[model samples]
Target chain A: MRSWKNHVRGELQQRDQTEKLPFIGVFTSLSQMEERFEFRKTCLDDVQSKSLDRGGREVGKDTRLLQLQLRESEHLAEKLSQTVSDLTTVLYLKEAELQYWQSRVSHFRQEALSLAKGSNAMKATLSEFEYTVECQSKELAALRTEQKGINQALEQACREKEELLQRWMEEKREEADRLNKYNAAQERWQRFAKQLKKHLHNARTKEFVPIVTSSWCGEAEMSTSVIQRINNTYRDTTMSKL
Target chain B: MADDKDVLRDVWFGRIPTCFLLNQDEVTEREAEPYYLLLPRVSYLTLVTDKVKKHFHKVIRTDDAEEMWFEYEGTPLKWHYPIGVLFDLHASNTVLPWSITVHFKNFPERDLLHCPSHSVIEAHFMSSIKEADALKHKSQVVNDMQKKDHKQLWMGLQNDKFDQFWAMNRKLMEYPTEDGGFRFIPFRIYQTLSDRPFIQKQFRPVSPEGHVHTLGDLLKEVYPVALPTEGGPKRFQVVIHGIEPLLETPLQWLSEHLSHPDSFLHICVIPVPSD
Candidate 1:
């Protein structure tokens, strides 16, 4: 009995070792602990084995889940790289278009400057042409004025010439009248001289008493004598029967 | 037409000294040739006035009567023979053949002033104007009036140089008939001289009216037709007629020329018997 009692006391003191195992270990009350202990050793061993198997299977399933997460990360990196390449191609095309527009704008500015210079040159030429036209118009107007003045002078000279000719004709008529009057007086004087000669000849012959005849008769006799002398003057015998 | 004009130019401008243009009725071509030949033979011609001298340039027929008493018109109102005609009862004077171109002791250059052809005619049957020549001129007038046609005779010739003609007056008074005026009788007058300056005043009845006019009235009109005859200086004790049918009425008197200085006829102024 005594030996049996000692064994019980030692087992009870070694209870801590069994408490770490099994289905229900480390019970608070000693009675249960004792009951379990008294219940059977096989039952405790079966429970420990079942615990080990469950822990190992759970660790393996956790490793398979980590491998699936790594494959998903690699697929995401490939898709991001393809999207960046596409963006670079689109930027290059936009830069080339900007350079072409800059060149075209510079060429258009140069053309505009040249056109402005040509326009200024044309404006100066037009001003010179306009001034030449003004000078020509002034010269033509002066010539027209001079031509009119000369025409007026010519008309005045013609009128003066006509007036002078009319005055000359009147003077000629007066001269003709003067010549006629002188001839008549000369004829009258010649008749008186002839009669005196005839009377002197008759007195020298001593034919009759000296008596003065009519003054008109002596003048008539003198006229006859003077005409006879004139008849005998040129080609004296030419007009004998005068 | 151009050729005809050239021919006429030759005829008009041709100037040989003597030229004869005879009407075919008066002279044939052959007869005119002789006169052209004779033209050069006449060396001298007598002229009474400067006007007459121009007509007879170098063709003179006589040189004896170079000095004579005659008168021509002058200008500026000198004294001219305005009225030397005799009235119906005026005196008669006889003037000798006073040559207008020449004269005797009474030589005068003034003769052409009164008569153009004074040298060609004598004033025989005229008024007795000079005391010396009046008695002889009166006797000569009485002898001239006895002839039957004596009254129609040319008593004197007066020079009319302005008219370029001679004024031949009859021995009797003659009437002048102007178209719109009253009739007037003009008796011919002449100057006469005999011894020294003897003058006689005598006149017979002259122009009697025919159509109530006198015989002398008709003679005045007829004188112009006969005075141009060649025998004017010779036959003019009377007015010598060359045309036939003596002057009762002078009408249509065309010239029928005979030989000059010999062929002579007389014109009578007798009273016509009352109808």
Candidate 2:
């Protein structure tokens, strides 16, 4: 009995030392210790009862029952130890699955941060493209309006050129007509003067008469004076006509 | 006076033989033959040159042809002038069948007005009539005429319908009996010796002293140089419709009988032929 008590006290000491495990491990170990304590209490009761009976046949039957109880307790202890090992394996697997999931979550977080930075850069580029497009469109519109204005001015200039050409042609025609008339008159006057000069030369040559100074000088002199008067009258008439 | 009505018929029916030959520089599809026509003396050149234009267009290429203009002796013929005036001014001394060059290019833009269509001729004719009426009756006679009446006058000239034109023209010639004649005789004196285009002035058919004005008196007042001095040789021949009327003809009589379709007495003073 003293040896059995010593064994139970050693088991209690081992259970108390094992209480320093993790929270869930400590709880499972404490439950297993309580079951062992109950089993030990039942075994102590059976031993006491057998001591009290003391009859030879009764003691033999009690010894057989105690042996069967001891076999049952050993089987139960083996099954509990297997259950504890299986629970420990499940905890280890669960911890490994948690570690894998935590690593995946961290990887996803890093990817999300990189995606956010890329999106910000894309947004800036998009806004710059939009701003540049707006400026280019504004410049195109201004150029289009300026082109229209230049076209209108070109058309106006063309119209003015046509009008100026018309006016210039009119003035040129008038000047040409005046010049033609002046030339025609000049030609006619030139021809007329040429004819008049020929007429005067012919008249002077025909009036030329040689005077002979022989006897009867007074008669010849009077005849020459009469011829001179006739020639003078002819020259005066020609001059008046001119 | 009854014989004077025949003068109008004679003037209207008067024609001049013209031969149109294409210019040497013009491009032609084939050899262009000369076209001949008897142009009316009273009508405009552009008005009566349709046949001439068609005849020339037959030989000219479509792309090479341009506005048709007439040239005579290197002088661009003014289409706006009456055919007789142009003939007497530039071609009276030439032989029969006055030779005119047909030009399909190089239009004399500086010398001649463009006659793109008959409308241009119509407008010019109507304006000339209006100007004459203004001088004769101060525009009262023309203003009283209906639009159709004016159109009839133009149509008559265009179609060579003398009766149609005379029907509307007699009304314009009318004047008050007490006035003895129109308010003023519209006359244009064209001299070959002067730089002026023509001499136009407001002169009454009768003088204020009640004496009938004469053609000689009009010339003396407007262009003294056109007349000959006393006992001086004749230097200028005052011609009207290819003939010289006696200077003693009354101004009103000339305006009524010798005036052109536009109702203007066109007197061309040319130098006397030396021959």
Candidate 3:
């Protein structure tokens, strides 16, 4: 039983150094300490009783074995007391760490709750913004349509102005041509009037006259005027067709 | 839209093509009053009056087979509304005392007038106090007072005529939002269906909410005369008014002739209208 107790103590104490759960290991070691103390007291009582009794050789040998067991148990009891004291400190440290973890969890939970509220508000704001954007897009489309119509009107006005300018140039060219023709006709008429006056003056003052101011002369003059009128009519008809 | 819905009730009054179930045995054997066998069945009503008092009587169904009687106390008159039966096998046949009987035949492919689209719809104008703005309610009076009598009469016909047709028609009143759901409205007739002058149309939208009165329910309330003369097929004139042009032929022909649109006309195809 003493050997088994020693093996259990060794295994339990070894676990304390290898694992982070020192508080649980220390509690198991403390339970073992109480058991070791009980074992030592029983061994010491057996040795003291054997020393007082007068038995056979067997009893004398039992007395020696009990003494040795008593010595080993006493050392084990001391080791167990130290382990129990160490267990008390470990348990205190574990309580402190647990308290720290609980407070940390609470702080993170509150932060998460506030963040969730903020995100929800952001979502609502985003939705309203999206709605506004949609309305703006529709209004922009309408404005663009109106602008397109105005641009088209402006382009049409420009085209009309260009056409009007071209027509004005055409009319000016035709007017200039008519003015030139009228001026030429006026000059010819003025020359004819001068010649007629000069001939009449000659008839009154000069002593001699050309062969005859006769019926043949008058007929020839009328025939030549008719031929000029026919030539002018042919030329005007040809000009109009061209 | 609600105003338009109320008009749907009136739309079926004269609109549905009514069929005649004449006692062929009487109309043919005896000289009768414009009675032709409706081949199908009908639900009708009657209002009685005298020098001193006014009585109202309504017969929901008519039977030719057995004797049946009903008495409503203190009221001088009786009113019956025939709850329409949709299929014949589903129908229960019964005879009102001194009245006629209706047999919704399971397989009457031969005897049936088979009014295809033509239908005569009876108005079930029952009134109530709920919604005062509503002068009349187009509903069945299956309330507590009417429940016992209704059960008694309906059960009396359960032997041969189980109202299998009526039961089937009742099952059809689901999904009211659907287009043709109202077409199966129990007691009302087809809109624009006519037979009198034969004013007709090739197409009409059937309003589903038209009320219906079954022939079985109508005969259950007919007042028996003291003379108790053997009644043949009681020729009842169900006068109706609102109608459409295209559905007149089928409606009129079915009531007067027991003919459906497809059965009577060679070209019986009606184009369904959309809203």
Superposed on the true interface residues, model 1 gives a C-alpha RMSD in angstroms of 99.9
lDDT of 2 by residue, B1-275 (tens): 11246567766766676778999999888999886666778898888888778778888899998899999989899898898888888877787667999998999898899999999999999999999999888999899999998998998898787766776787777787578999889999887666787899999889989999888999999888989999999999887877677677778877887789999999999999888
Candidate 1: Cα lDDT at B153: 25
When summed lDDT is taken over every stretch of 10 residues in candidate 2 chain A, the lowest stretch is A15-24
lDDT (tens digit, per residue) of candidate 3 on A68-118: 676786777988898786567456645754665577579779888998999
Candidate 1 C-alpha lDDT tens digits along B1-275: 01122221221121111122222333122332211111100011222133233223233334422332322121111112211111000111112111122121233434333334433232322221211122223233335454322222222113211111101111111112222111221222222221222111222122334233322333345343323346444222221111112333211110111101111111222112233
Report, for candidate 3, the interface RMSD: 48.9
Backbone clashes, each candidate: 78, 0, 81
lDDT of 2 by residue, A15-128 (tens): 223222123344346446755666676776767676567764345666757765885678699899987975675576457646755876797799889999999999999999
Off by over 4 Å in 1: A1-97, A158-242, B1-275
Worst 10 residues of 1 chain B by lDDT: B254-263
lDDT of 3 by residue, B1-275 (tens): 01122222221111111122223332132333321111112222221111001101111222332211121121111122221212111111221111222222232443222322111211121221111102111222233224344333333222112222122212211223334222221223221123322222222124235423222222222211111135644222122221112212222222212211111111111213232
> What stretches of model 3 exceed 4 Å from their correct place?
A1-64, A180-242, B1-275
Model 2 misplaced stretches (Cα beyond 4 Å):
A1-242, B1-3
lDDT of 3: 0.34
RMSD of each: 83.4, 62.8, 38.6
